[model samples]
Target: MSLDDKNTLAVEGGSPVRNTLLPYGHQCIDEDDIKAVVDVLRSDWLTTGPKVAEFEKRFAEMVGAKYAVAVNSGTAALHAAAFAAGIGPGDEVIATPMTFAASANCVLYCGGRPVFGDVEADTLLLDPSSVESKVSPKTKAIIAVDYAGQPCDYDALKKLSDEHGLILIADACHALGATYKNRKVGTLADMTVFSFHPVKHITTGEGGMVVTDNPDFAVRLCAFRNHGITADHRQREAEGSWFYEMAELGYNYRLPDINCALGLSQLKKLDKFVARRRQIAALYDSAFADMPALFSLAQRDDRKSSYHLYVVRLNLSKLNASRQQVFGALRAENIGVNVHYIPVYWHPYYNKLGYGKGLCPVAEKAYEEIVTLPLFPAMSDRDTGDVIKAVKKVLRVYAE
Candidate 1:
């Protein structure tokens, strides 16, 4: 069909993308997932049980990390990692503002200040140079997030951390199945964190993990998750003693056995799930290749993304419609579109903490045009086609 003919028809819009609705993301749970949870329910142990250890061990092996500590949520994992890294009062941790608030909040939880850094304009990943510019004498750590499942430029980040004698924490919450320079996300930094929320690559209802090669950090993480208690109940009973000691101030961040069982089951299928997500991303990339009004986040050559979110940045200057209008039009066509983030520092709480609009110019500008489309393992080919059609229609109708 002629380009003008296609554009005209789409603007008139006789048919919507799909007859029904599709959420931005959804978990793919099967019979095995249900059986795993049921098996845990039938067992004697629920929280702080053998299943937790099993999940940790298996996950560590999968990611080529020496140790792994399971936690109740991604925020808990980040908090434990930050605390273990010695982030406290008077310390500053550099982090990208393009991620969820939890990434920065973890530093606050440790009584440390979070220094927001601008992101790369094309990749939307943390800009290493920007992070270095934010570093100061009080800087103690760099929490680099694997935004949109793409690993950040770790080599550059590590160099900055080493130069400043700072800890490097990989917020791999969106990048469990991702790889950087052929290494898994879990082993990329000093302490790597993963999330098992329903929208992530794997789901334990709501759980997370911290993986590291340092045994000391693993021990600290364990204690931090259990209210700084030295020994668990099972360990005390096995030693023929009812003695446990509180070593430090910690939070109740332990993941339950039921959730671990589900996590373990989900881990078995992570490779497949990531592959499907990548396929969906490829389809989107191909469909949008020639579209001038939209561009997807750039993937780096040194890493393989897990495709946690297929976000497209609209070229608002080339379009007659604003981002909000296009987003609303897509939703009106049953295309479940959403924005990935509104810069972490833009939140009211952060603003109250003295962080204002100009914290990160790149991130602020990106936030204005970014739109997250429906991309999940459970989405079928037909479903993907619907999303593609819907996006094209919206852009066509709004094209300058």
Candidate 2:
């Protein structure tokens, strides 16, 4: 529960009074994940091999999905899902702006136009009412981001999507272990995507998975991940490799066996990781509960968060200083506080498409007050204390 200030800041151990440096988010790795990769390295296949299939099967079963397709990255999985879902030119895919650009960019990848839907004032997740306002004749899909590992109001969003005859793509990158109304997130959307980057709940170096119950979509996604060429032919070829025809144009987005092995290993510890994360979050929750001057996102009814990134909304009106100053002061204190996102439309790329201002005002306002706090399963109690202490210290100095 301690961090060494004089040495590398990887683990906890510091002076009696020296504050521990807390990171916003990071992955948890154990001997098991490493051993899994080592075992794979010594096996027969390396890339696009047996381990990949094994990982997909286990992961699909974990999330209660009929099938899962592993890809090189979350963005790739999104792109494949969009492509196979028939997102083409002039098609509109509604989403919230409070997420990373990848959520909307995936729509653009398949020549679909990304439409921004405002968020709920509290959760900062896609608002079903706002989403309804953006649906048009060309609307083909709705990609709802599970921001902060909390599932968006899927039941409402589902009704809207169903009414419009649009697909629902849950960018569940932040909600792998999250649940909505007692059901897992992966099974709630038409296509649920997950990320295994170093900063996520798990680590596969760089990997993502697309889960769906539709067999046809699974077949198309599998083909799309491997250059649209059927791997069934490769398995049958013995003497000489027979040429395979492209059922449709696709990309090489399949994840390597090494990454899949790492993911599979990490998946084994998924429950443990989530439990630890919740424990840490509970400590923070208790610490910040009495501080009403701050605005923390409240847990909702019938939902379980994965605690991917525990964000606290700064009550800018109560503080004597601006958000930038407070954020800067925290970083100077080595607290490593970060911002979750800057509304997707605020990015210049989206601006070029004439997605100008005055859209999703709620999300834009949340962006101004949002600050991501350190939350990782590997975080020690001392690390959590340091983050809490740093935050309180900065707020005390900045508060009127």
Candidate 3:
């Protein structure tokens, strides 16, 4: 079982490093999480109830935000935030292309255009200078994605937003417990969005939240998630009235009480979950620090990442294989390595919109080499070791 043996490369008909595939990400559910959901199921309220409010309150407190609005999914959260910011026809929002399509698509949902901004070569974060260059008279806001769970340079971005009189939104779905300059992510931007997908730091089955200090944005968010209604059914019942009005068009994006209950329970273990993710990331960093075939994404000294994805950039010049070849080899080795994203504008849909290639050179280049590794709280040390060994073995076999 010598890792140095090229004949052991799984892609070459040799045995894999591990018998079972190691997923890039997974959820860690405990008995306590089950009990919380069961309690909600046993209760009378299932949809919108006290649990939703409780979850909102606790989550806001956790992130140091003055208000929180829970929604059905991260996409809904982004749409709600865009609506709250008053994005409309002819407006433009600057966002990095190195993120999930939803980050940019949300702007299109509100009848606004999403202008692609380049990322830094090392960190893959939205480059402030690129954002500044993209700003125009049509620019209404900036959606800064906390790619790979690390916070962007908020100070630089905040100054740019203030100078332009534009709103700053944080797509922090990957950064639940991350911090920037000792401040939690939710408090950094004008509005911060978090996702509770199973693979995220916490799970609510399928839920998301938007935290903001602005009461106006909070009100808009609440209304937007519930068909733009001024008051919910509970409020009407409490007032002994049956009448309600939809002031504006909105979506049915309400997150169920059942999901909120699970989120509340998961929230209790968020710090622990984040700590384990960071530990796993540290282990990977140590193992890959000297590996010439690849290098991990850069981390800033002032910000701490929750490490939702331990992504690495392959040094293709140092190896004889392409990223696709390496990716396939890792898969053959039972290592579920994946790419975080394709440049958003490169998608067929966006391409039809006349967004040509080479829009964001740095992001487009990074996409060609990046690979996401296994990173989750439930992974044991041995699981991490298997990933490291498999990656090293595969890359070593292809190294020039």
Top lDDT prediction, candidate number = 3
lDDT of 1 at 353: 96
Question: What stretches of model 3 exceed 4 Å from their correct place?
Answer: 1-6
Tell me which of candidates 1 and 2 scores higher on lDDT.
1
Pairs with steric clashes in candidate 3 = none
Q: Across residues 195-253, which tens digit of lDDT does each residue of candidate 3 receive?
A: 99999999998999999999999999999999999999999999999999999899999
lDDT of 2 at 360: 82
Candidate 2 local lDDT, residue 66:
98
Candidate 1 versus the native: TM-score? 0.97
Q: List per-prediction Cα lDDT, in the order shown.
A: 0.92, 0.86, 0.95
lDDT of 2 by residue, 1-400 (tens): 3354432222122332234456788778888888989988999878888888899999999999999999999999899999879999989999889988999999888888899999988888888999999899989999999998988889998999888898999999999899999999899989999998888888799999999999989998999987888764347565367767788889989898999999988988899898888898889889998875576887788789998889999998788888888787777667888998999998897888898877888988888898998888888898888888777767766778
User: Which digits, one per residue and each the tens of the lDDT, describe model 1 over residues 1-400?
Assistant: 5534544333245555667889999999999999999998999988889999999999999999999999999999999999999999999999999999999999999899999989999999999999989999999999999999999999999999999899999999999899999988887799999999999999999999999999899899999999999999989989999989999999999999999999999999999999999999999999999999999899888899999999999999889988888887888788898898989999999989998998889999999999999989999999999899888877887888
Listed in order, each prediction's TM-score against the native is 0.97, 0.93, 0.98
Model 3 weakest 10-residue run by lDDT: 1-10
After superposition of all CA atoms, the RMSD between model 3 and the true structure is 1.5
